[model samples]
Target: MRFLRNALLALAACAFAARPAMAQEILRDTESEALLQDMAAPIVKAAGFQPGAIDIVLLNDPSINAFVAGGQAIYIHSGLIETADNANEVQGVIAHEMGHITGGHVIRSSEGMADASRISILSLLLGAVAVAAGSAEAGMGAIMAGQRAALGKFLAFTRVQESSADAAGAKFLSDAGISGRGSIAFFDKLMGEEIRHGISQDDDEQFVRTHPMTGDRMSRLRDVYSKDPAWNTPVDPQLQSRFVLMKAKLEGYLATPEATLRDYPLSRDDEAALYARAYAYHKDARMDQAIAETDALLSREPDNPYFLELKGQVLLESGRPDEALESLRRANELTRNSPLIAAIFGHALIATEDPAHYDEARQVLRAAVARDRDNPFAWYQLGVVYAAQGDEPRARLASAEQQILSREYARALMSARAAESALPKDTPDWLRAQDIRMQAEAELERSRDRR
Candidate 1:
């Protein structure tokens, strides 16, 4: 409910508020994530990267922006998705970011980040020392200076990369057989905003601050869309429908219940409307209404895995884990064992507290982790089950795996070392222990160097 998690891989773990306060927080929603992946698949492949290789992260911020960070991952704001009229708009944004990745823009930027990190550490340390000495002005100045320098280095990209990404993104959409009209439309929207508000030297919006607009940029995009055959193509109806449903769900979860009702009134009779209302009801603890809405969806699409997953989640979260089991089990079966769903299923099984079900829970969690190594929740749950079964060494190793995936390097190293000492040498578990210990140690060294 709160979030899952990597060393750096875990840096992007389930939605967490970035320390030192960089952004609102990250979020993890399986349904929304599935929609994003569906839209991004063709675009990522067109950009010459395996779709699975690029992680799509949903940020909780309500700002219209998208960017690549920490390598290979695309972070898109929930506001952008909610604001988009259709799947193509979101996909266009994704393609553009992918263009940056394929263009090696992020890699080029990392060189500056390395230097910036050092400067940031030094400045922060000096600031802390000054503050300890009661020199408030000096401390604040040092902190501000460091932040400005780091930001300057980080944002030193030219308009050239932006333009090139625009062109490359359009090509990717065209090659992938998706219309470039959405991309053009989005740029047009941004251009209109720029015209109305006028450019600010210090615009607060990340997108506006980073992406400079120019007549040439606008003309280039228009040219790309105007001449392309797919320019006028409509988004796939199924994809558009899914996008609508996804947006509705986000509104239900992220917005106030009254706001959700106003936006998705009961007067509206659609699958998406019902789905949104279900989440709203669930959020408000009106279980009867929530269950009714979920059942309505189930009546229409009995085998819809997402609906079933939602039903299971609602029941589990509502303290009816026993009742949740059937829905979750069926959902997992229907979806071919989605790790996210399985993780939840495993949770339900563990919550039942039936000793008879412990092995089954372990089995389910093991399968889930095997399929998705980045799922910290699954790893953590697996650790719990191991501990419950009196498998101390294995439990510690599982804990280490979860910690490592969570970027808790020092804690992970201690657990891994303990597991290694307790477990047999050269065995698979021992070998994994060795691997985690080494990785944790390396990360610890890097962390020290940064300080």
Candidate 2:
């Protein structure tokens, strides 16, 4: 599991090649990502997007929310996953966010904001004129009224977008042949939370809110969904099973050990419970218990790559790098060298501190990074391999790759320039270094202008 918090501002920055500073930790796990992809594939395809064109990122946050922030990606908070009862609920969420993407809502949001700003400015000007005429009380009232009008206008615009997204989501679910029951159910849960938190549910509250009231959303969705043929379709058992395990795994990773153990006690012997306790034990530094839990999971499904990955991660972090290699290697093979898992496996090979493993680490990491250039961690590991082999120029190039992704433009510029000066002219590595140098310089210039 990779938690990109500080070094990576947002995975979207790398994944989408867009630099939007978001102060949220990104959670990267192979199993969760694979399952999310599987769950979202049909919905995404139904929305006319090609496979793998959209990314679903998990944020290590406790807020029950999902959003599309200027990319063909859905950012789902861990809390939302934890709150969901099944994978279908998440698919419903994904379909809604996809609606925003297809509708160009993120790009169009600026228009709404700009329109509201104009109304406010016009109101302020009229208020100033009234004040100049010696009616200060009337001017104050006008200004307040203008502010309210601007807010109402913006809120109404957003409400329309939300309704559009809701309709689009329902249509996508219908097109994908997935039941909308989960969509209505999830909204029902949101309504329950609103009531539990003492949020006003009256019609007066709807105008001030960005989204339509949960009750209203659910009512409309239920009407449309009940008429759809997929409404009574059964949930995919395998998908639901995976969702349970994923949710449990997330809870164990995010919650305190005490809470994890309390919720998933040792008495529970199910796969989900074992998965949760494995992470819980690992977090608490109970290596023996963690290994035991992982072993139990592997025993149930001997070829399960995720269980092996967990075991390898536990062993590697617990200073058992030599022991981690076999499990990680097998996990990497089973996953067909998934970039994230392969990176971890390469790290394990390097952690052995044996020269014999360095060559393999270099090969594995090089391929991993080649497949996923956005992975700064893989580039860092590859750099270590190059440095170990006394290849300073390539080492610098790798560092440049990592530094650029981490938004260290000045350091990236220096590293890329150093690599470029030393490497053979017009070679692939040289070209890459030059590209990094130019990109870094442009970013730095943009930064200076912004400042």
TM-score, candidate number 2: 0.94
lDDT of 2: 0.88
lDDT of each residue in 272-365, candidate 1, tens digit only: 8898899999999998888888999999999888899889889888899999999999999987788998999999999988878899999999
Candidate 1 clashes between residue pairs 3 or more apart in a chain or in different chains:
6-10, 6-405, 15-26
Off by over 4 Å in 1: 1-24, 110-157, 192-210, 214-216, 445-451
Clash pairs, candidate 2, are: none
Q: Write the per-residue lDDT of candidate 2 for residues 103-212, one digit (tens) a residue.
A: 88777765665666677777788889999999998887887787777767766777787899999999999999999999988998888888999999998888877788
Q: Least lDDT summed over 10 consecutive residues: which range in candidate 1?
A: 1-10
Q: Cα lDDT for residue 188, model 1?
A: 69
Q: What is the lDDT of residue 181 in candidate 1?
A: 78
Clashes of each: 3, 0
Q: Give the range where candidate 2 is weakest over 10 consecutive residues by summed lDDT.
A: 1-10
Q: Each prediction's Cα lDDT score?
A: 0.80, 0.88
